[model samples]
Target: MGHYSLGVDIGGTFTDIVLLDVQSGDHFSHKELTTPDQPELGVLRGVRILLKRCAVQPQQVVRVVHATTLFTNALIERRGAVTGMITTEGFRDVLEIGRERRYDLYDNFLELIEPLVPRELRLEVAERTEPDGSISRPLDRDQLLAAGQKLKTLGVESIAVAFLHSYRNPEHETAAVQMLQAQLPGIAISSSAAVVAEIREYERFSTTVANAYVKPLADRYISSLEDSLRQEGITAPLFLMQSNGGLVHTKEAKRLPVQLLESGPAAGALVAAQFGRDVSETKILAFDMGGTTAKLSVIEDGEPLVAYTFEAARQKRFRTGSGLPIKISTIELIEIGAGGGSIAHVDHLGLLKVGPRSAGSQPGPACYQKGGEHPTVTDANLCLGYLNPDTFAGGTMKISEAAAKQALDTVAKTLDMDTASCVPGVTDVVNENMAAAARVHIAERGGDAREYSLLVTGGGGPLHGYSVAKKLRLRRMLCPPSAGVASALGLLIAPPKVTRVTTFSNRLSQIKIDALEHAYQELEASAVQTLKESGASSTALVTRRYADLRFVGQGFELVTELPAGPYGDSTPDRIRELFADEYKRVFAITPPVNDVEIVNVRIDVSGAADAKLGKQRDEAATESRVPVRRKAYCPDLAKTVDMPVHQRANLVAGATVAGPAIVEESVSTLIVGSHGSFELLENGIIAVELNTGDRA
Candidate 1:
């Protein structure tokens, strides 16, 4: 009975549910329209449908891994629990004083994201910790009680505790948190040192407060989900996907929901990395375009980039400084942009613009025919004949081309053009938006966009990937099997991982190896203990060591992986050489002769990844094959053309299809332009190679 693993990814517009047979490594998936008001209902509905449809019993499900965007949406919409902040005296304004930098320096009117805890809720207590990690003054118990009382009186559901020099010595913060929990039973409390044991004051406090703000809401959702799963007779141990492309027990997720901010997208990136390695391509630009947003990530050397800090709830999507900063171990991704449900309209300046706003699942896109009259990218695709009316979502849902064109008339008429004439521009605008973002994102990472192959995932990704790749001047694109549910598939293969971070400031020459060794052992033990409590099992457990290093006087540092060591004498020079190589690669300049400083030390412990543990070739290899001919509007040729359409399931390994053509699947469709040829590889991916010297 314990032979299946289930994975669910709750996205903005769709809840993807996949059931994997552990004995056979075969998987089946279904997508359900998300219920925004009560997300758990939609997830439960999809779970039941997939299980019953696949004829799988609930008792067969032994493990469940879930990834969700609920907490991130809550943060962006400012709908989290009422939260308060407790800090040392004279640091009451840390949130407001946020590095004292403006995102848009020249704009006359600039608005920053308001702190999660209001000024009235940010109370300070008497405490002092010197820069040298000495506790000069003891904690004031009376003041702490008074602060807790004020928060309770104000109806604060959660509280964050932060004190000066907490990274070096968390005694005051820990004691205060323990007291608050004992005195104020049932109130959620978070300590800054526990959340992020680093040196930055504002960022640490912000990360802690963000954790507290989302605590109650996440706890409620997780509890509800677990209860619903139990009611459905699926009593598997449920795990949650973290933003770092790792799995953690539900208890850890509930305690620190902020770390799940980019959970779903991070899963997609992980799957992309695995897919790239499978194809022997180490560098990949993973493009995931869902209903509401498109995310891009760069993977090099078969691993996605890992960033130590992230910005959340940005005022502007592409602007770096216009958001709340949180410190954590997370997969690095480009800023999000337009996707399938992004609205299309003419601006005040008489130019068409795609969105930073979306028509979410409730109303969805116009072609869904559920009361949405505004034109969207989905509507444009339908008007262009890229989507079929009867086969949308494997015939579970239907779309109307007439309704799509009627909706497009809103913008077409405004531009004094027919819907056919106005349609290509909508797709072009969206594709260019994604391509521009990709180019800039790759350039900022010191890589060229043309150097990486595009790997497409999500419902919208395959439909738009060809155009985006052309605009980026990329030579190849790849579409995985079961593209629409890739993120959910990713969750099924995610290994349990835990990270431990601490500050250790010292120059390379003066480094105390014995002290560092002791700290590393403690951090490793902590991470191992947390992983043990999660109850995940995998072969070949692994530990990675990293340090944040920088030139002696630099304001920021680059995270560098350090060689595992039983350090005695040669460790300092090894670290120095690694730092110099990385520095020269990034800046194209030689490192200074002076010794550099190590700002932070981190350890990430993970089991051998599940995707590596086992893989079953897709079932498409055994299916009967058939190809049909259909006439669809070719955007590249600016005319309707007759092309052969093949069902992805019917195509066996090594089959080739030349464009212009369409490869249709149950959940997604691939639109290949006339400038490329697609080959169904042995691993079930349609690898597209563009014709050289031809621009689509």
Candidate 2:
């Protein structure tokens, strides 16, 4: 009996499926337009296509990994189930109160984010837990039971349990849950301590609410998907991609779906990091422009940066604290509503705005001929001659160039310009928007965009990589094979992993090593259990640790990786040295007089698995000499030129292409600008560099 692995990624516009023969390393991919009415429709369709194309029996599939933006979309669109929250009596408004600090202090009109759980839905119970994990006050069992019944009567789909200081001690929360289960068995429940287990009250409360909001939907979807797979004879264990850049068993994922809010984007970051590992000493700015959004992440030293919390459904798209804060260990990335399906129009000032609104897959872009009259980036790409009408999606869907012209002409006529002018106008605006977002995001992270190599992946990424790179004065861009479904492919590269966080808050010198070690042991055990449940083999275990430490008086902390071994024998000197090294890298110097405190400790347990991406073949020994040509817009030269085109399959080892060329693959295109050239690296990467008017 042969075994196979399947990865399913559901996006805003399309659902992608990848089937791999675990033994032979053969793979097949399929893409289907998403059905917002029922996401499972697209997922099932894509899976059927992939399995059919590979002529593989579903029973042969040993494991299935799924990633979706459904939770994220539900939050952003405010389409989640009716949910209610239960918290400590005194903290009923914690989510609304927040820190009370305005992100922009001087701006009086700054909009505040609306709490996910409105006051009406936030029921209070007399229960309290101290920060030290001691029960300050016993939970009112009767009160919690009554509250559960009240919520059930009100037709609440789910309930969030977020008692004060629950991170330190979840006893009260657990008791409350027991009571809620006894009284309201139908309502789904999410506990904060189980989800985030961190110190912040507002973040914890909000995260719990977010979890409650999405639990019902996630549970239904996961259940439906599982049944569908089983019906197709796929008895494989199913896993889901979490925000922490790891895979979790489907059973655990349902219990804690909040960790998967940014699952799709995190998978993209994983793909970028895997690519980065092959290119030594390269800083990567990963660009993933799909149908509904363009996602960006900064990768340094082959690891994507991690963030503790992210806001979703932001009222103000680019600003923090303008949306529901979700607490999870997620690969930090920024998103802009600037993708192929992003709508374009002339604004009130007669200035063109590319988007924050998307046409999406239902009607899609006008070029998709799905009844969308709105001009979109895809329409613009079609009008600008970047997309092939018959070859789009491998000719699976017919693209109407005439429809694109009509849509672009609408914007053009409104602006007193032509479609040609309108197309570039929208394209330029989109590029500038992406570039500006890149600048702000990179600067905040204390990075210079010019110093990083841009790895563009996704359907729309290659189409706009050149222009965006030019805007940022970046000369290099690399597009991987199957870039359109890169996120799904990335699922194969990710390890089975878990990130557990605990708040310690003790001065390093005065810390009780025994208690700390015990905490670490517990966390590690939990992580190992999670991995085992996910079907990780014994040989795959790889446990790593980190701590969030800072000077006693500092408001923020820096994360430092900790050595994992026999915790009892480790010296303070070893710990201090690691802290100092990380500290100096950020602040240039460590204070000799300041007392350092370990605020939080994080444990990451990983189970390594074989990445299915085959090793790079030697190009010189394996490719053809065929080079086709196409007319493309060269922004540097500021004109449409007949550019040499080469099938990526034919570009072998040592193959070099000068500027003003296009490397077309089945999945994506790599545009070589007039100021840069590309060469096939021995490791299978198309290494891009500045031409500087000289060539080897």
Candidate 3:
């Protein structure tokens, strides 16, 4: 008897499910169209299909890990619950005022992001706390109750309480929350200190408000999903993927759903890092292109970069300050609206543009035959012969080539070109868009894209990775098996972790060692409690410490790992040396006179590490089946060519394929250009090497 783990990841267009046997290291996967009206319905359907396909019983499932983009979608679509905010008097407009910096300076029609909570719903109460954790003005209980009653009368479903200096002292906010919860019994309440206990007021309040806005929705969905699973005979413990690339208990997720804003993308990055480590490639560029968006992340030394702040629903995709900011630890990545279902059209200036809008699963690509008439990247790929209509999705789903052509023709007529000619332009535009976004993201982090190997995952990633890599002047790419569901698999491989952070600003030289020790001790206690709630034993817990340090006057801080210890006089000097080393590594120079300041401390406690999946076993070599040849458009040659198509499953280890070929897998396809070649590694990964001639 063996225990099994199920991983479910709900993306914008698809729900991916992976079921893995812990003892035998075997797995099964399935993908289904996401039900936007009820996302959990898709999850349940995928799970049922996958379990039946694998002939596994629901009782064998011991754990369930899930990641979803529902919260992110709700924020972008403004479909969340009616939410209100309560703050200290005179600070009710903090969310609207927001740093008072315009994202675009010269534009006369600049539109800043509107706060989630409107001005009328943002009530104020008389309460104040000093930065030093002292209560300057006692919380006005009567005023707080009146505000709560007003919100209740207005039919607000959720409330966020953010007072001035709440991060320093949560007493006032906590008191307000108690009163609100007592009066409005069914209403959801979120406090800034509990959601994101950081110093920045705008980010903290935004994060708390966002959490409250989504809490009722998440709570209902999770509860419904649990009940559905129970009815289906699954008694497993449920965990959720967090934006920080860790898994937390369902209880924790319901309390702070804002931390799951980028959960799906973070899982993809984790899987990319795992694959990079497996191949011994430390510098990796993780590129994941699914149906609705493309995500790119950089990994160094088998670790992805982590940031304490993230933005959502950006008005401008490439601009940093054009979105609502949330303060939560997350993997740093850049996401663009380049994906398989991205629509292509001619703009008002007659220039061709490929999406910031998508035809998601409901009416996906024209080839899907679900009544979509718009030309999309998938339609272009189909028209260009990059996709096989007969074998798409293992032939379970039919593709309409006529529909694809009709869709492409509409856009082609607008561009004044034949469909064949427009096919390459559409694909090239999307690939270039991704390449440009990757370049900007890497350059901003002081990295050179040419120095990294691209690890491609997701359905569209392997299809377009070669071209994207060529644009970036990269020569290597790796596509793992079952790439379409890699993110779901990542959930199975992730370790259960809990991270706790607190602001502890102090100059390094003048820091009180006793206070620092107490802070860490408290964080560790909290982390331990969280991990315990997630089912990790005390003996199996491993704690790591980090400190955010910067020059006294700097606006941003860099995190450095600190050694476990009871701090003494000598520990500060060691900490300084670590900071200097890190500074030199990042900036290539160490300042001489500026004193270092500690801004925040973080604690990460993780459970026992997950076992890695075993490599695919090799079978006895047999006579290779004759490759099928198809006439496909070659972007490099600017014409159609007779390209060979090989089934990925039939290609054994050490098998090689030349350029201008298509390697078709059950769920994805890899298109190798004329100047590129691919070799199947023993680990079931395709290593693609692109020559310089592959560039456009």
Per-model TM against the reference: 0.97, 0.95, 0.97
Off by over 4 Å in 3: 615-624, 693-696
Residue pairs clashing in model 1 are none
- Model 3 local distance difference test score: 0.87
lDDT of 3 at 137: 91
Better of 2 and 3 by lDDT: 3
What alpha-carbon RMSD in Å does predicted model 3 have with respect to the real structure?
Answer: 2.0
lDDT of 2 by residue, 516-597 (tens): 7877888989989888887888576888888888877888788888888556545455777888899888778888645678
Candidate 2 — worst ten consecutive residues by lDDT sum? 615-624
Off by over 4 Å in 1: 537-539, 611-626, 692-696
User: For candidate 2, what's the RMSD?
Assistant: 2.7
Q: lDDT of each model, Cα atoms only?
A: 0.87, 0.82, 0.87
Model 2 TM-score, all chains together = 0.95
User: Cα lDDT for residue 559, model 2?
Assistant: 85
Candidate 1 accuracy as TM-score: 0.97
After best superposition, candidate 2 residue 308: deviation in angstroms? 1.8
Instruction: Evaluate model 2: give its lDDT.
Output: 0.82
* Tens-digit lDDT string for candidate 1 (1-696): 478888899887888887887766778888899998999899889888888887888998998899998988888999999999999999989999998999998878899889999999999999998767899999999999999999999999999999998999999999999899998998999999999999999999999999999999999999999999999999999999999998999989998888898999999999998899989997899999998899999999999999989899998887777889999889999756587889999999999998877888879888898999889999998877788788787567888888888999989999999888899899999999999999999999788888899999999999999989988888999999878889999998888999889998999889988877777778988888788888745345688888899988888898888888566688888988888888888889965557889999899989754543143323343344667777777757878788777778776678666789888887888999998889988877899987647443
